[model samples]
Target: MEYITLNNGIKMPIVGTGTNTYGKENKDYNGALTNEIPELVTALELGYRSIDAAISYRNEELVGGILAESSVPREELFITTKIPAREEYVSSKESTRAAIDNSLKNFQTDYLDLLLIHAPIEDKEQLKNTWKVFEEYYEAGKLKAIGVSNFRKNHLDELKEFAKVKPAVNQIQINLKEKNEDLLALLQDEGITPVAWGPMKTEAHQQELLDEIGKAYDKSGAQVLLKYQIQRGVVVIPKSHNRANQAANLDLFDFELTAADVEKIENL
Candidate 1:
């Protein structure tokens, strides 16, 4: 797998697995939790090291248990989990610290690879307090890096007023349908890596075009879409339950898209 160096000099896998719906009944995001996550096991077996999880998903312990029990050592894994912006999780500094501590206990790890505020908090004081707690953990070495997700320019500007550590990444939707061109440029200019969440969401026509492009490289449209994001320095977390598709997602290192190919897709 390829890696992107964050602003803090940590290498994050260019490709990772999104676990928003994993271990849930019928693979539904709101489905009841299941005891086991065979898909996560399959992903790890397929060489996926980056596991993107969030507290809002309500399955951290399950996901964490699988990872703790996996054959892959903790050092080789890049586990990322987010703390929600809700009152229960970020109402105060003490609440925020407790939430993070519980997350660490659930993961059975001394330190997390990356921690992020799940979304932008509207209250400036709450936001500052939550970020301060994150900074505290980061300084103590419990969090390798700290960042935010789903933050826009205004939110980032608010954070800049007192932030000492620049966000390492801003995880956002960056599929073909939602190009997020302006925000992408802003993130690039600010030296923050952009991690695409829905990297495989594309229109049928777009997929057809990507498939046509992939034919030259013996890859699928999904692969082509993921390749397009990573080629431009954007990290992608594209998840699939099918074993074949899971294996295919990691088969991206073998080919490179031409300038013409990139232009065609970019214009699409």
Candidate 2:
């Protein structure tokens, strides 16, 4: 896997596993929130050093549980977690500190590789307050780098006007179906790399487009979809409790999706 250097000089994996499920952490490890059987272990063993998560998922403890049990050294792993919205985080600024402290405690770590402000598109001041803690954390050497999630250009603009430290990344919904070239270009110009959550969009609205491209590559629709995003320099985090799909995502490094094949799948 390739790595993207954040503006702060932290090296982050260009690809990783996303853990987002809405359920109690006490369920079966595979039940979005329940199943922890072997998927987390599989991802680490597969050379995916980065793990993206958020508090809203209610799986941070499980994710942390898995990491603690793994042989992967904490230094070698790039673990990223987010502060949920204000109410959950409590108060934007103060909550970020408490949330991060809890994350470290739950994960059984002293510091985090990265931290992000989860979606707060409506409250601009609260967002800035949340970011202030991120800045403080970085300054304190508790977090290596900081960024945002599900943010649009306008939201970014609002951040820039108040932020002293520019975000290192913007995790968003980007895929073959929703190719926001305008936003991508804007982010590139600002030096913030775009990381995609649902990059293939096979679960969203790109199934038909993925189907067409799948035939050309002799690959599954999901494969073609992921390949297209990679070609555009978007970092993809495709999650699956299925070990086969997790392994399949790592195999993408070898194949080359032709330019014509990519154009054919554009925004369909």
Candidate 3:
């Protein structure tokens, strides 16, 4: 798998599996927990190392258990999870610390490859306190790196007021539908990596365009879309329960898009 170097010098797999709906009934995001994630096992068997999870997904323990039980060693896996900005997890520094500790225990590991605030905190004080705790964990080696998700430029500017460590990534929607070109540029300028979620949520028209682009590379439209993002330095976590699609998602390293193809994709 290919990797991207974050601002803090830590390497992250450019491709990963998203677990937002894994282990849930019928693969529904809001479905009841089934306590088993066969898809995750398939992903691992297919050589996916990076796993993106979140506390709000309500299945961290199950996902963590599956990950821990896998044959892959902890060091080789790039595990990333998030702490929600809700009151329960961010009421105070202690609350945030407890949440992280529970996550570590759930994952059955001493340190996580990366941790992120699931979303922006509107309360400035709460945001500062939460970030401080993240910094503390990072400094103590409990977390390899720390970052935020769904943050806008103003939120980042607010964080810069007293932040000592720059956020390593900003997880956000980056499909052809949402584009988010401006924020993408800002992340580039700040040296923060962009992790794309819902990466396959392209419009039908866009898919047609991507399909046409893929014809030249002998790849699928989904592959073309993911390539467009990763080729421009964005990490993509496109999840699929189908084993073939999972394998196809990691099949991005074998080809390169020419500058003209990239430009066409950019303008699409």
Candidate 4:
């Protein structure tokens, strides 16, 4: 797998598996855990080194269980979780610290590879206070890297005003359909890594282009789309419950898109 060095010098996998559907889709949390535990384990066994999880996903404990049982060593894996921007958690520094402690306990890991504020809250003061707590954890070694998700350029600019450590990443919905080049350029200018959450989705008008490109490389449309994002220097966390699909998503290092091909896709 490819790796990107964060501004803070921490290395993260360029591709990873997102575990958002572990318990959100199903009504029965227990049953969802029963199904998701082995599915996550299967992904690990199939060579997924990074796992993107969140407190809002409500399956960190199940993920922790699989981590304990997997043959993969802890040091080789990259685990990331987020602190939800609810009133109870982000209202004060003490609550934010407790939230981090809770996530560490749920994941059963002493230190997280990365932590992000799930989204911007209504109260800017509360968000800044929460970020202060994240800086503390980063200094204390509880978190290796810190970032934000779903934040616009204005939000980031505001945060930068009072932030001691600028965000290392900004996770957002970046797909073939919504390129959001302006936001991406801003991130680049600010020295923040762009992490794409829904990296594979493509518009109907773009499918023919992806398919034609895939034919040249003997890859699927999904593979070609993923390669496009990686070539553009974006980290992707594609979610899939199927083991075959999970494996296919990771099989992107063999072929590359040419400059011409990238330009064609960009024009679409």
Candidate 5:
């Protein structure tokens, strides 16, 4: 697996499995419907080492259930989870500690490879509060790296100016249908790793984005999507329930997309 170092100096795999189906639980996504906890184990067994989960997904424990039973050494996996919603903690440190405590418990691990604030950042005061806690965890050896999801350039900037530790990763939506260059530039400037979600255009109107890219690369839509993201130095963790899709998603190491080909697909 290819990996990139976060700003805080943690090496994270460029491609990982995202578990965000919504229908089975309170969330509005697909993972809830699939309830494919076995797939988590399957992915690990298949040789993919990174797993991204979130509290709101309500499957951390299920995932942990697998981790507890599996033999993928605690050090070999890059496990990440998120804080679902804003909690009224007295201090950011308190919030960070409590969340990590719960997450480690959920994942059945002793530490986190990466922890991200799972929503678009809103205000300076709130971010300061949160980053404070994130830093505390990092110093205490509970979290290896810290970042946010759904944050745009503006949000990244505000937090950056006051941040004690630069964000190690920013999880956002980036794919053929929507390539946010400004977002990409902003992230690249600080060496803040960009972790892309929905690299395959989930729920997008351009369902065939993959098919088109697939034809060019002689690969599946999923493989092409993941390839594009990694080519741009962005980490992507797309979710799939079908075993074939799971295998196809990670089968991207063999091929290379040219500059001309990349532009053609990037514009699509």
Candidate 6:
């Protein structure tokens, strides 16, 4: 798998699997919070080393169970979780500290590869206070890297004003249809890694172009779209419950997109 070095000098897999069930009616599947454990096992078995999880997903314990049972060593896997941007946690220092502890306990892991603020809260001071706690954990080695998610340029600028440690990554919704080029450029300027959460989501009109591109590479339309984002230096965590789909997502490094192909996708 390909990797990207964060500003903090830690390498992260450019492609990972996101554990989130947004539209499912049944939140619990096979006794887990969601269909996380089985699918996670499938992903890991398929050579997916990075797992993106969050407190809001409510499946950390199940994921931990799968990790414990898997043959893959702890050091081989990159685990990431997040803190909710609610008042109970973000507004208080002690609660924020507990949140990290809780996640470690839930995951049954000593240290997280990465941690992020799930989203930017309305209160800037509260968010800053929470980030300060993250800095403390990062210094203490509980968290290998710290970052934020769903943050706009202004939110990042606000944090930068008082931040002692700059954010290593900014997780956002970046897909074939929603490019968000300006924000991506801003992240590049700040030396922050831009992680795409929904990297495979494409509109109907754009699928034909992606399919045509994929035909040349003997890849699927989704693979073509993922390659496009990866070429632009974006980290992607595409979620799928199917093992075949998971394997297909990781099978992207074999082919290279030409400058002309990249430009065509960028213009779409």
Q: Please name the candidate that would achieve the greatest TM-score relative to the true structure.
A: 1
Task: Please report, in order, the local distance difference test score of every candidate based on alpha carbons.
Answer: 0.95, 0.78, 0.95, 0.88, 0.78, 0.88
TM-score, per-candidate, Cα-based: 0.99, 0.87, 0.99, 0.95, 0.88, 0.95
129-150, model 3: which lDDT tens digit per residue?
Answer: 9999999999999999999999
Q: Residue by residue across 78-188, what tens digits does model 5's lDDT show?
A: 988988546543235677567778888988878889889888546567678788888888889988888888888778768868888888888888876567778888889
- Model 1 error, position 266 (Å): 0.5
lDDT of 1 by residue, 216-236 (tens): 999998899899999999999
> Which runs of model 3 end up more than 4 angstroms from their true locations?
none
Query: Which lDDT tens digits does candidate 4 get at residues 150-189?
Result: 9998889889889999899999999877888899989988
Candidate 6: clashing pairs of residues: none
Q: Give the per-residue lDDT digits (tens) of candidate 2, residues 57-77.
A: 778888888888899999988
Compared with the true structure, model 4 gives a TM-score of 0.95
Candidate 5 vs. true structure, TM-score: 0.88
After superposition of all CA atoms, the RMSD between model 1 and the true structure is: 0.5
The lDDT of model 2 is 0.78
Give a tens-digit lDDT track for model 6, residues 57-109: 77777777787778999988899888999877887889999999999998788
* Count of backbone collisions in candidate 3: 0
> Which residue pairs overlap in candidate 2's backbone?
27-34, 28-34, 28-35, 29-34, 29-35, 29-36, 30-35, 31-35
